[model samples]
Target: MTPAPAGRDPDARASLPLLLDAVLGVGSEPELQATLQHIVDSATELCAARYGALGVVDPERVRLTGLYTAGMTEAERAALPELPDGRTGLPGALISDPRPLMPQDLSKDSRAAGLPPGHPLMRSYLGVPIRVHTEVFGHLHLAGKEGGGPFTDQDLALLRVLASQAGTAIGNARLYETARRRERWIEGAAAVTTTLLAGRPAADALMCVAERARLLADAAAGVVLQPTPEGGMEIVAASTHGDPGDLVGTTIAPGSAVLGQLLGGEPVFIEDSATDPRMTTPVRERFGPSMMLPLQSGGRLIGTLALPRPRGGRPYDAVDRLLASQFASQAALALVLADAQHDREQLAVYEDRDRIARDLHDLVVQRLFATEMMLESTKKRAAAAPAGDTVGEDTVGEDLARAVDELDSTIQEVRTAIFALQQPPSDAPTTFRGRVLRETGGAAVLLGFQPSVQFTGAVDTLLPEPVAGDLLAALRAALAAAHRRSEVTSIEVAVDATPARVRLTVTDDGRTTSGTRGTTRTWESAL
Candidate 1:
């Protein structure tokens, strides 16, 4: 196309370059907020107006929820009693119709509601709605024409061009921002899963989820609540900039409206927790917009994850809700997998204990018992030697008796160990016989092997409390004495209980201080 003569269309020649520059200026900013502000600034400059603002429309409420302005000083803004909500005057008219508004004089326009108190005055008005695809994103307002003249049709046309380009720039910025936000949430979920599966304790794992979610959601607090036996939900973990003690342990009662939904595994989103009738917890008044998401995996409800912002904080949008729910689902699955791994680890430990017990019983105990029998036969033969044979022979017989007693003690110690290894690691034995076995089991660690244990005639039933206490005390003293002996090799513990009496016999093949080998100590008490 041939260009029009500059001399004939001087206004067009001057305005076309300014319009192109303004379009490039608005699209240059990649950030959403920066892009919006730049559009407002460019429009005010292009229209030669002293003031300009962009009012963002909330589709749900059909109201201006946010405002970005240019050419207004900080002091001037601070002096104003309140900002406009785009619900009255020309701004409201523009929003209702989504069409351009250009009045020759604002005072003559019926839609004018007059300037707000302490706000700058003088008005040659121009307003235009900005569109992104098919939706009206917001409207741009310009007032106080710089040359003290009313905005002309030429100025309005220039602004329309700028607004159209601004829409495309805003759309691209929004898409970029959404992609970045989704990336952050995904990374947070992956971090939580890695931490949970790293063998963190259950409490720590719950806390990790809360902390990570709070950071990603930009919430004031993050909390995890588990179902109680009473069918209520109690906060078990909390993450917040402030002390979380107040949040932890807060409960939603069984009959509470929110609790019912949470227990049923449904998510609850509250516009303002402080004012929501469904919120009944004492701590609810401290929060504003909140999301309570159910943490569940395969129909098993693990808990609830709650992210609550401070009162009057920004409300979560549709994108925020969608990302958070996805995080919750992933976190729940990780929790279940971690729990299963922990159970498998415990089973492996138990199996190892069983193997050790079997080895002691089937191999060590049998060999020790056979040795004890062989020693007993040797002692008997030596005792039958002639008394007049020699002093050396007498010494040999005494040593043989000690050897036989030591073998018997060694066999008993191995048996005690086998029994101890068979008991559950977490459960403490309550019965008196079990308690006696426990004591001997403890001594085995220091003794390098288990001590022998024998329970005669219903020891757990027949032994009285007082008798059992005293017998245990005497048994401890005897074991200590045996441990003190340098040559101590084995200990035999025998607990005999009857209807009338109980006797605890402790014998060790340890040499006494007086050089005598084989020591026997007995504690007797009446039932």
Candidate 2:
């Protein structure tokens, strides 16, 4: 027998305007979720079911994307651990088959065994597939008709109508959400480029990308990793809503399965970071649902951009993956261009410094030398006529000597300044090793011999700033003291920054004014 029209039955006619309003009123909802909730409520009321739910399957089509339910209290929803994802058994039949289904007495259905432990015992079911265009998006499952009777054909008919309209509303909502996400990511990319090209330092440029990406992706932490010279990856920059120390400087050792792919400019997705075999870093234990996207431009891999959410966080969907990857590519290109700009700016600075050095040597030093020569000549003449002259020849000689000493000191200072200007701005001593080497190299000229320098352990990476400053100052003092001693022919400098302490030893084979032998000075500081 055929089902009667909902409009013909007196009771169904009363609900006709409501059902039609639920369909036509969909356009009134500016937010897709509100419209969907309204549809679910209308379906439950029309069919006289205790519960109604719309399950949206993920694009992978393997599981439920999300579940929106009606007729359940907040307490009931909260007691559940997480939403179901196609493990609903018989009701899932509609999901797989994309057809209308109405079943009573679920215990008899073997497939109902997959139902969750705490799910309310549901009986007398009605379900219909929600489709978008030709594709099945998900299914709507309604259960437990009120008034104690089996659901008639009329209830199934009304549910189908709502399911049909639900498909259209859900599709529009998804499109709007995707567009918003794309807008955010694109804006993030533009922001990154703008901030990087504004002449910030290299480290700051990387951080800008991290901060913006973390906000856009709503991740717990955003980290930027670069391939190390030691055939590994190092976290060079990170942005976090909490403490960043743990996230920064984390390393992925060589021979890592994940690093290999990342270095090759491929993206890696992790469902659960704490358990994923490919994630070997210690930080992985704190996060889940991670995306590691390579930042590459012009066939050169700059680094990997990783955004990981806290444990049990929502998984990244297809749109998230795509937009984040695109952002990474754009960020990489901006980084490359920013670095080039920095190099060009440095070149200009170097050229200006070189010109200044030339001017100092050609004009200032030459003039100072000429004055010294004139002063020396006057001193010599004064000394030659000293014995017979009544004029204060002693005073004249002392004045000329003092003038020559001052001029020599001035020239030495000017020469030192010019030497300083010669070193490239980029090569300035920023690390402990570089600073130590610079000090020794600068002293070599005064000693007329290069100092033999040796290092033990990671001096550059392990040495702290305060100790490094103290050590460098002492080294300069020792070198200057050595220059004053007579017969200084050789010098040696050693810096051993061990795990527990930093030790510095300097030895010079130079005799003091007293006929003493070589001298050795040692300094130590706890790390």
Name the candidate that leads on lDDT. 1
lDDT of 1 by residue, 303-335 (tens): 999999999787888889999999999999999
RMSD of each predicted structure:
14.1, 15.3
User: Which residue segments of model 2 deviate by more than 4 Å?
Assistant: 1-7, 365-527
Give the alpha-carbon lDDT of every model.
0.85, 0.81
Clashes of 2: 0
Clashes of each: 4, 0
How well does model 1 score by local distance difference test? 0.85
TM-score of candidate 1 versus the correct structure, residues matched by position: 0.73
Where does candidate 1 stray beyond 4 Å? 1-9, 114-116, 379-527
The ten-residue window of minimal lDDT in model 2 covers: 415-424
Residue pairs of candidate 1 with colliding backbone atoms: 412-452, 413-450, 413-451, 413-452
lDDT of 2 by residue, 1-527 (tens): 87776658866666788788777765566576787777778788778889888777765746786788988889888877766778468646666677787766665767666766567777677888878888887777788789756677778777788788877887788788788889889988998999998878889999998989999999989999998999999999999987899878899999988988988889999988999999999989999999999999999999999999999888898889999999999999999999998888688767857766786778667768777777777767776874778576766767677776667555554654544443345545578888778777777766678888999999988788999988976786677667767888888999988789999999998897579979999999999
